[model samples]
Target: MDQFILTFLKNASEKNFQQLTGRFLPHYFTLISKVGGMISPETLTSIQKALQEGRLADIVSKIQEVITAAENAVLEVAVIGESGTGKSSFINALRGLSHTAEEAADVGVVETTMHKTPYQHPKYPKVTFWDLPGTGTPNFLPDTYLDKVGFEYYDFFIIISSSRFTLNDARLAQKIKDSGKKFYFVRTKVDSDLYNEEKTKPTTFKEDRVLQQIRDYCLANLSDIGVSEPRIFLISNFDLDRFDFPKLEETLLKEVPCHKRHMFALLLPNISDASIEIKRSFLQEKIWLEALRSAALAFIPCMTFLMGFDLPQQEQCLKGYRSYFGLDDKSIEEIAEKLDTPVQDIKGHLKCLDFWSLVKDDSIVAKSINCVEAFCAVNGGPSSSVVQGFKAYILRSKFLNVVADDAKHLLREIETVNIA
Candidate 1:
């Protein structure tokens, strides 16, 4: 038994060893003893009690439930501003949808929103952006605006303005602060401002100088309106990679709670290399958790017979990674259309197995198991069931790394196309 455990730990790490020793080792020993026809009556009664209890599956299921809840967590954001402030356009941009897209908020020069309209993000449906009605109107008063719009529903507020922040904006900010909710000030249509400045001033205009002036002007106005230490982000609905969009994204991620920060970072448009890398890191952090989940699933009776020890779970995980990185067929087509490049040209840059094919084909799972088995045979096959769990964990980690690499490659391909 000691030799078996030593061989198992040789293949498995100390972490997995500790987990198995604490949770499954007793049952494993009983199972082995029964198989070897050496079970005493006392041990048999204990095994029967363990079998009757059956808490392992329940515990694993509860863990899975918690993980699913975290992944599907909702992030409610309120986009509020006065009339003609490009609030809807900014919401559309945040969702990675064009103004004319069917899922986009109504983007009109006039105030189109009469009530609070919730727009679910195209990629992350749980992340809802509410396009609140224009403030400072006869019906929507600043003092009672929070009550009218049900401000309690929002996780955070974004106060937008095309020019300087208004008194209404400041009041809303103060109200949000009083309610213990965070708010951000966004100066929209910055691309237009920069373009006009460059066109009119030519050699005399410095881009950085113009941007700084705009920032200072917004800050001063916001400060005058009673918003202390005002943080203003300048952005353009038409161009997310420019101006202060990246900084705004970073700031929001830092401000939001830990569980919801991934939702914000993952849903951000794949516009810049920094954004892509942020998404990559976010996904990378989940690999270990996913590997453990898959390993646990492999210990389930029906799942134990599956090729590659829970390859379906691994395939599903990789599929999700592909979707999050915008590498699925639909997303790829969208990128290709946006870049004016053929879909095949983008697909050629992928470094891993085709994501859809891997999920759809069982033969792929068998082939993967065969490869793993061959490799393990050369390295000395895992000596026990616990060692097999560790083997599955390692295999899943390798597959995650491969999928991540493919995502990075696809992002670089998109970037190259954009530059060209």
Candidate 2:
């Protein structure tokens, strides 16, 4: 297979190679040019070997494999704080679940989490949020907290506090830093504080001023305890869209490794317009890679035996987009239930063609195949089997855009309901 790929590249003109490589290997090119310093030695070696051997197909396959592995990778986020700081509620919010949801972390005014408990995201199970036991409790003292909770296992930590950042929080942050792990200070229950302030001083109270005061207080506390330049995010567990939660989400996406950033963006709760837009852009960037993978798979000799290959792959990719954007029937039903609105009302907002129906439509399939044949004819007519892959790529790319637009429209509808 490698020999065949090498021979094919050798026969192709340099201009053709450049055009094809630009189309199919855009992600690889971006990674090499933008993140060259951060690429792992093993990954660099694999890419260099593919280039040296002129195995275009293998390179595409390897790139797709790397992306798939990253998508399936486990992301462990630890939520640690003093007891009654709303860590459990924050975890639930982050996972897009109500505190009453079956898999939600237990929330209480008292210390509920006695031990480190991992709660998997309802939609993306590969992403787990660990609710670590309270830091200042006698059972889990600040001094030995990191070792007790197995700190190394977590990709990052969120050290939360209800009021002021305490000495225990500062110590934990320092410890996490010393261990070379990232930690963010989260000031939770800001809604309760704001409510109290509004009630006490309704005439003079300003939400922005109150929020700034809270932030400054938290910063002062952390600074007094010798924690330098602490990154503090203020949030309300009940309202993730308010205050600093969006900025926190952006920071996490930027700070994590490149592959993991994609997972974070994809799995983020579809609460705010900004979040929905981010998800759309991340998935959009991924379409080229998916198309290239489809094209490469089409070139495989044995792929013809696998039920013609292209249709099934296209179906799977479309299904993934549906699942990711919460466009499927189950997701829509859940949203309707949560908003106390009719399921049809929510579904009405969707502007995309029904992907599931299209997958089963014989006419659409025939039209797609014909379109592929026409495309091949314009390029001097490639083999029918090979053309099927190109058809799959084009079809998937078209639907991907449709699903993304539908997701945006759905988000607007939800926002309208929220406003009302």
Candidate 3:
């Protein structure tokens, strides 16, 4: 938890450095970095001897190289919808920005976003949200939208709408589908209407059923447009928790392919344990590859240094890696603001799995940790009797993975074959 440790971890993660230095390197380097400015010449000389003799130099060098690559990596997402479906607001929400007219501008809803308006998420600018004008303007043809937006550039499409789907929305969706890209239907602004309906509820018993009814309504509407068994997400850009934003995310995660989904998880507004796990897994995938490649690069047969540092670094680098992958505080708050799910509920979802326990300090230490202790720490942790039920309903759910595979298959075809 020391500031330097945090800084070191952040820098290393951003750089994609995944070597484990072990009992010797972490403590030695951390101490050195802390005292490097004031250390005596003799002391510095001794440390250098230890580093060279112990063979830490090569490990450090490789770590630096991979870290730099991760920092330079860019993942871009394309936002598509007919004009005025709150694409801009959705982008702002995803990026953790306020909803001022100038800040979250869409085409018909505000001033038309003349070209592709790129919005950077506050946390990761390397990942972008590109907002294109509605493909459904009065005289605009469906193909024109694809031409203007350059459909091939985006990793995926986020189709947005505040109300009913229009011809433009359908056209764009079809194009994306035909082109073999992934798209999600985001129903924004459910908070205002839901709240109004709650205010005028005829019976308290009907509240739960009301939500289900709304979902059914949306699905039926999509079905009318030939979207068979349509899975529509009821979301509110203003209140994330209150609406079906979680379901929306689940849907998106399910449909997005693994290759890009990893990055998608990285860009998500981290709120729950599942989100944290998916994000960590995504980042870890890259680091794993980086580390593996670095080890391969150090394949010089006569290099004595490789023997001392390479193996240890590779084995231990993933230690404390999990903490680096979870949603940071800002992302969680942004998600909380939009979902209207009490930040506590989001925290509660994570806390349920002894997430804090599994996450040692701020880093991912192991694949799995004892959640029982975390549960005990938090008021006996969901009575032992219900643990199985909890896992079945929540933690172990395979819903997200199922959707991701479907989307991944779709994208593989598109990415491999260029459709004119």
Give TM per candidate: 0.75, 0.82, 0.53
lDDT of each: 0.68, 0.72, 0.50
TM-score of structure candidate 1: 0.75
Which ranges in model 3 have alpha carbons more than 4 Å from their true place?
Answer: 1-74, 100-115, 202-205, 254-257, 283-300, 303-420
Q: Identify the runs in model 1 with alpha carbons over 4 angstroms from their true place.
A: 1-66, 292-308, 353-392, 416-420
Candidate 3 per-residue lDDT, tens place, 1-420, comes to 122222322323333233322322444344321112122345335434433443334444544444454455566778776666678777876764677535454434564765678876655667788988666666567876776678877767877776777667777778888888877777777776667787887456365676677777667777777665555677777655456776666666555433334445556654444554455444433433233233322222333222222223322332223223322344346556655556665555443223324223222221112332233343333333222222221221222222233223322332334332
Model 3 lDDT on a 0 to 1 scale = 0.50
Candidate 1, poorest ten consecutive residues by summed lDDT:
31-40
Deviation (Å) of 20 in candidate 3: 20
Model 3 lDDT at residue 384: 37
Candidate 2: TM-score? 0.82
Q: Give the TM-score of candidate 3.
A: 0.53
True-vs-predicted CA distance for residue 287, candidate 3, Å? 5.6
